[model samples]
Target: MAKIIPFKAVRPTRDKVTLVASRSYQSYTQAELEARMDYNPFSFLHIVNPGYKYHKDIKGKDRYTLVKNRYLEFKEDGIFIQDEKPSYYIYKIVNRDGLTFSGIIAAAGTEDYQTDVIKKHEDTIEYRENIFKDYLKTVGFNAEPVLLTYPDNKIVANIISEIQKERSEYEFTTTYRDTHYLWKLDDKDSIRTISLEFEKMKTIYIADGHHRSASSVLLAEQLKSENKKHTGNEPYNYFMSFLIPESELKIHEFNRLVKDLNGLSKETFLIKLDAIFRIENRGNQLYEPSKKHHFSMYLDGDFYSLFLRKNNDAFKTALDALDTQILYKKVLEPILGISDLRNDTRIAYSHGKNDMATIKSKVDSGEFAVGFGLVAITVKELKAIADEGLTMPPKSTYIEPKLRSGVTIYEF
Candidate 1:
């Protein structure tokens, strides 16, 4: 069973939240980052990029200490305040595309992660995990919560519907045009009800933030080993998470871009692909894959449809059945001579939100010789993969409702 607890989050004051909240630092280009630090005094960018204040770039432990200092300064200046009582936050985001996501923010048990009650479909890099664990140990807080999705529950849904009827504590729109709203559920009864409802769930799958969660768990274990009087109820025992129903998750597929067709001529390549797929010439009007096993291809200024021949491909596992994996096994490896999906320079990817025309343009520009579009994987497939303890291919899915940092902070 899942054990979720409320936390007294350190959040930006209502007046500064609109300005203080920011997308992850890496998302911004150097110029955009400089512009934010120059014009937006209250932006969370100032805290993370503390070196900006001194007009020099800082890295590693030095930067971590400075980040802690900036965060404390924000608290001293009354830009941030901690809640008087532990509470679960109901956060809602309405994107520019009009997709709305609502979820509960709470401290989820690290024990659940250890026991596999909190599942993951992606692998985390140990080197990056250790780097972030060290940063968290120095800074002593987490601003961005890991996104977790569970099976839909009517009891939880009712609670959210009722809470959303009241006025929110923070309601603001970002320059990116997305509106964010947050409501506090500090009342004892409501908090218990929500927590108990989550306990009934068998498992929750990580929709995003695999590395963050892994790092937090690593930090928790390290701290436990260091303290002789460690207790299970300490702050290190839990990490912040955004829990939503699986139905609310939006998944997109990654389109493949290859630099060349290996040594095979176009005619030979098509012949090899024909063994596993029924190829159709779509004549460049624009094509997109609409179903599992169906794929869209762009080659030599012409668009083609590749439908997996019935019963031609076999799957012994969930990963084996994935469209991306099928493409690799049948076309990329055996025919195109491209392997090592992670380190291979021959392959690149475009998001599903980017349409077929975007992929075609890349191939037409001589940057890539071919492009392949695949149907997005379903939530059922994702859960199945996680249940089997299997990791998906790199960049296999593009998830939505990308979160912001500094909206709420979980401190040790």
Candidate 2:
């Protein structure tokens, strides 16, 4: 069974939360990052980007040490405080688009990840994992929780609904216009009830933060080997996670862009694609795939819809049925000769949130030879892939709600 336990999170004071909670550092452009750090002293970016204060770019263990120092400074300055009691945090986000996501923030067992109780649908890079593991080991805290989704349960839902009735501990709006509300659930009975409900669940799926989860597990193993008095209940044994219902997950597709046609003429490429797809040209009109196994492509100033030829016996596993997989097998690999999706410079991905206009613009500007739009993968498909112990293609999903860092901190 899955294991989830409450922790006493270190959080920014209610008054400073709006300024302190920030989107992941990479999300910001260099100019935007500079502006925020210049104007907002309380922003968490200062802690992560410690070099900003020194006007130097710090790297490796030096950066890690400086990050730790900045975090301590925040606490000393009274911008952050720790809860005396262990409790589950009920966190809710209502984005500017008016979509809502609610979940519980707690510690999830690394053992659960090891034993497959906490499932994954994406593969993590080893070097990236090790880099983050080293950073976590030095910093000794995780400010960002991995996004996890579980099968919906009435018992857990009812508990969250009841707790939300009262005024939240932290209610603030970000510059993105997203409102965040957090309630502390420390009462013993309610904590027990939430714990019991989660314990009944067999598995949970990772929606985002695969590297964070993998690095946390790696750190736990390292810490266990080093400690002579190792105990299973140590903070290192679990990583922080935000657990929501599967239904609450918002998934978007990643449209593909290719720089060149892999030495093939546009007509020849269409001919090769025609072997697996029944093609139709929708000239000068924007189009997006409407269903599974269907795809929309923009090439040489026209849009085309490609339908998978019926009775193709390719789908043997959950991974095979994915639209991204189908596109790779039918077009990207065989027709275009672009096989390494991760490392290939010939290809790029844009999230569906950008819409077809971005795809058309990029292709029309001579940056890319063609662009392909796919229907978003469904929750059922995602769960099936995880359940089958399979990983999806890279960039297959663009998931939300994109969480904010420094909202809650889990320390070892």
Best by TM-score: 2
TM-score of each: 0.98, 0.99
Backbone clashes (count) for model 1: 0
Q: For model 1, how does the per-residue alpha-carbon lDDT over 60-156 read when each residue is reduced to its tens digit?
A: 9999999999999999999999999999999999999999999899999889999999999988889999999999999999999999998898988
For candidate 2, lDDT tens digit of each residue in 1-412?
8899999999999889999999999999999999999999999999999999999999999999999999999999999999999999999999999999999999999999999999999999999999999999999999999999999999999999999999999999988999999999999999998899888989888999999999999999999999999989999999999999999999999999999999989898899888888999999888988899889999999999999998664678999899999889878898788899999999999999999889999999999999999999999999999999999999999999888999999999
Off by over 4 Å in 2: none
- Give every collision pair in model 1: none
TM-score, predicted candidate 1 vs. hidden true structure: 0.98
Which residue pairs in model 2 clash with each other? none
